[model samples]
Target: MFWWFERSGEHLRLEVLQLAADKYELRVIDADGTARVETFANADDLAKRQTQLQHALSSQGWTGPHGWVM
Candidate 1:
């Protein structure tokens, strides 16, 4: 899945990926091209972290998670 957040005309991207049957990754790429990657062992953990991330982003004034599954 892919998501986008925008702030002051800058865009940031988030990607959810399954690296293996039991391994998943959440990647956040900033508008400046810096990337932060986190791995999870299951969907539940990924979901929780995604929520936390969204809240943090929102607090930072990012205006969306406009997204789609890939």
Candidate 2:
């Protein structure tokens, strides 16, 4: 799983990639996906988010693909 965040006036963007087993990598990208800042973190704190994503694919009356998008 991954996500990006952008602000109104900044040329910088943040890309977060979820690795496996509660690990994740973050990359600060330019508007064109050029890397500016890169780092990794133990994403165990994101347990709830992970569960929510799974539910979105399979539960609460939803259905479709499973797991991360990319």
Each prediction's RMSD to truth = 0.6, 9.6
Please tell me which predicted candidate would have the highest TM-score against the true structure.
1
What are the lDDT figures for the candidates, one per model?
0.97, 0.47
Q: Point out the worst 10-residue segment of candidate 2 by lDDT.
A: 60-69
What's the TM-score of each model vs. the native? 0.97, 0.36
Tens digit per residue, CA lDDT, model 1, 1-70: 9999999999999999999999999999999999999999999999999999999999999999998987
The CA lDDT at 44 in model 2 is: 56
Root mean square deviation (Cα) for candidate 2 = 9.6
Candidate maximizing lDDT: 1
- Lowest lDDT 10-residue stretch of candidate 1: 61-70
**CA deviation > 4 Å runs, candidate 2:** 1-10, 31-33, 44-70
Cα misplacement distance, residue 26 of candidate 1 (Å): 0.3
